[model samples]
Structure formats: structure tokens, C-alpha cells
Target: MVRERSSHWNQKCRCLLLGLTVILILGAVVVFAAVILAGRRDPPAELPQWKGRGSTANLEEIILGRCFIYTRIVNPELRKDCLKIWETFKNAFVSKNPCNITEQDYQPLMELAAHPIQCNKTLLWSKTNELAHKYTKVQGNLLTLEDTLLGYMADGLTWCGSPSSSETNYQSCPHWRECANNPVSIYWKMASKTFAEAVCGVVHVMLNGSINHAFGNSSIFGSVEVHHLNPKKVHLMKIWVMHNIGEQPSDSCSGSSIKELKSIIEGKNITFSCEDDHRAVQLIQCVGQPEEPACRVCRTEF
Candidate 1:
């Protein structure tokens, strides 16, 4: 009997050890999984680069630059006024031109007014250093509107008379100020695309990388290189200027396909000197613009 009791005790001890071993294994597995996930999280900063080149098929950029609004839009009432202006102008068609009112959908003016608000046009450009540090493309969106007109103008819902790309202007009945028959119009789809956010220095988000829509040609693009920060996100380093007429695209847009802007940087670095410093350069892609050169600055390998 004593021997039998001894055997039972041995069996119970073995089961306890086995349970502890299973628990330890599960704990080790959970710890490993957590480390791998943490390693894959997104980085908190963005890198910089210049923009150049573009495609003709996509609409041309209308108002290029930042829209600087000087006001306190934090208040709920202020926000309401901003939205009201947009709602009114978005439907601001003369009601005479059914096509302009119905088909265009104020897309033209909305495209033009997508910049951050500034008192004057010059403020939108190169800052004199004092304001440059305060204003950034990422933080620009947070600045609120002091006026209603700008919000109306930028909103996709607001209409800007009739925007037409065709040289042929349509004559309308009795004149009514600037409103006469046709408002100085822009071809919304033909002009340029406005982004969810406005960028600085150069208009980078308007490139093929961010929008991803196919242009007149069957070609499609993925990412534009600004830096190695985010491989999945588009960097505004490469730009497409767009050819409105006889101008041919810059030589960079020629043969082969590009998945990202890396293809351009991969080539031999073209080195040059500037006012007080030496620089390296290379051509990426050219979409063609009226006069702007397609080349810009980028990172180079030594």
C-alpha cells in the first residue's frame, strides 16, 4: 500500500512541472511578438528635398503658393462663418450657364484657393526668416481663418464663375460687373489638383506621386523621393511642371519606368557649385511648364 502511495505522489509532481513549463513558453512567445511590432512603428519626423518636372495629362495647378489666413478660427462661431462662405460660393453659379453651374461644381476656383492665408501674395513666398520658422506646411493647416471669403474660395464646394481652359470664351447676355456672363474661369480638371494639405517653398503634393491618378497618357506613378524617411509615403522632391502647349517634356521623362524617385538618384551624381557652396544634381522627370526649368536640387552620393 505504501508503495502504491509513493507512485501516485511521483505522478502528481511530474504533472506540476509540465504545467509550469507550458506557462513559461507562452510568456516567452508574447514578449518576442511585442518587440517586433514596436520596431515596425512609424517614425515621427519628415525629411526634405526640392521638387521638379511633371505630366501634361493631369490638370494644371491653379493657385500655386500658401494661403495665409490671419485670424482666430478656433471659436465655433468663426468656423460656422467659414463654412457658410464656402457653401454660398460653391453654388455661386449665375444660373444662366447650366453646364457651368451643374457640371463644373466650382472645381476651378476651389483648386485656385487651396493655399494657406497670408495678408498679401509676397508673404506666401520665401519668408524673411522671422516668419519662416513659425510657418510650416505641416502646421499651416492648424492656423485659422480671420475672413470668410478665403474659406469659400478654397472649398471644393464653392464656385468661381465659369472656369474654362479653351481659348474660346463664351459670350453672355447683359454684363453684370465681373459676373457679366462669364466669370474669369479656370478648367478645374484641366488646371491643377488641390491637396488635402498645402506645402511650402514649392508645390510638391501636386505631383504624380501623391495623387496617383493616371494622366492623359496611360502612365501611373507611385512615390516621389524627398528622403528615405518614409518609403510608403510620397516625398515632394520630384515635380512635374506640365506642358500646356507646344513645349515638349524635359528629357528626363523619356524611356523606362520609375516606381519611385530613387531611380533618378541612382544614376551618377551631377556635381556643381553655387554662390558659396558646391552642389550635386541629376534630372528626374519633366512634365513641361511654360518657362520654369525642370531641374532642382536633391541628395547625392559622394
Candidate 2:
């Protein structure tokens, strides 16, 4: 009888302990759920706009600014799955400018990105600057002549001669004469055309146009596959501006940054968008009609 009573007490104690253990586990799970919910709070919203000061052509500044935003702000600050994010927008800017390529074989530059980025930046800046300077010099002379004539006109000075003198309105200056002898008129027309055509025309092409040599059918730049390898070592290959005929330095880390586990990129296409939009439009207008500027509408073609 005593053994039976002891067994009953022991069983009751075991049941109580098991029930307590299950309660503690259930309480822990609830607490864990609450903590997770608290941690998730609200996500941050994107900023609406960017700020800067400077007169710009619009297209150039906007495009460059977008690149800056990607390099300096978006790419570094975001800690999300970088490879997946990268693949989403790698060639997005190209949608705005089709000339800009989308898919690139970036296997070569993985070694470079893991380390310092300064070396590559230095090399690209040097080339872009060199070419920009050369372009400036070539166009400077022509632009100067245009500037001088423009100044003269703003002051109401005419090379053809005295603003047409009229008695009906004596205070009014004489209009520029259409007479043949005036050297000022002759000189103005000559200088105006000289620089405007020779200088500004090339400027239009370099800044907005490209001689696309590669990966197209009979394009002006012609099958443009230029390979420039090893900066510190011997530069056996030709070096171009920031954009090469073939490979570009910015493409170095683009590969490792692109691929992700869940996403298969074999033949899949990603439609790209620009986070930083430098909406610059290029419009070329001539002072006179078709004769003065042969390439009057100089936005796309040279």
C-alpha cells in the first residue's frame, strides 16, 4: 500500500515537471516572436532628390552625376545582397543611352577590385582628361572668333558700317550698311565661319558622338575590340580614353558583383534604369541658315 502511494506521488511530480517544461518552451517562442517583430519596425524610404550647383549642358552633367551616385553613394552604402542588386542595374544606364553596353565579360578584373580602386581611377581620369584637353584646344580657336563677333553685335556695332542714319528718327543709330567696301563685314563673316565649322563641329562629335568601331555592322569606329592590359607593367597595347575600343577599367569588378545564387543569368535579360539621371540634351543651332552651318542640326550625327 505504501509503494502504491509513493508511485502515485512520483507520477504526479513527473507530470507537473513535464507540463512546466512545455510551458517554458511556449513562453520562449512567444518572446522570440515579439523580439523579431520589434526589430523589423519600418524600412527606410528613398531620398527624393539630389543637390548641386553649377551651370551644365544637362546631358553630360546628369550622366556623370549618376555614375558618381552609384560609385560613391548607392553601391557602397547598401549592405543588401550586393551581387543580386548589382545584376539588376549593371547596364541600366544603357537604356538611356543604347550606345552604352550592357553585358560584358569581366573575368579579367576580379583581382583588381578586391584591392584598391584608386589605381584604376587614376589611369582612366588621365586618359579622359588628356582627350578632353586635346578636344578643347582644337575647338578653342574657332570658339574664340565666334565669341568676338558675338560681343561686337551685343554692343550694336556693325562691320557693314554706320547704323542706317535716318532723319525721321534722328536719335536712332544708322543701321549697318550693306555696302561692298566695309572690311569689318567681310572680316566678321570670314572669322565667324572659320572657327564655327572647323572647331565647334568637332566638339559636337567628340562630346556627343563616338566612332563606334566594334561589335556592329560597318559602323564608323569599326569592330572596336581594343585590349589595354597592365598599367604598371609594359603597355604593349594601345590605351584609349575612359572608354576603350574593347575593355574598360570600370568593368573590372562588374562580374563578381553581378551573379547571385538564386538568379540564373545565362540568357536572362535585365531591363536597366538609371538611379542618377543627368538629363542633358544637346542642341546645336546656327546663327545663319543652312549655308553658315552645314551641320545645322548637330545632336546625334557628326
Give the Cα lDDT of each candidate.
0.30, 0.28
Q: What's model 1's overall lDDT? A: 0.30
Error of 2 at 5 (Å): 6.1
Tens digit of per-residue lDDT, candidate 1, span 241-285: 222123343222231322223353333131111110001101112
Candidate 2, residue 26: how far the Cα is off, in Å: 5.0
Per-residue alpha-carbon lDDT of candidate 2 for residues 1-302, written as tens digits (9 for 90 to 100) = 99999999999999999999999999999999999999998865322121211112332334334434544563454233334332322222211211122223111111111222221111111113334344334444322221222212212222111122211111221222423222223233332323222221111112111222211222111111111212232212112212322223342112222222002112222221111111111112122223343324457756
The clash number for model 2 is 19
TM-scores of all predicted structures = 0.22, 0.19
Model 2 lDDT at residue 156: 22
Model 1 residue runs over 4 Å out of place are 1-80, 101-200, 205-237, 240-302
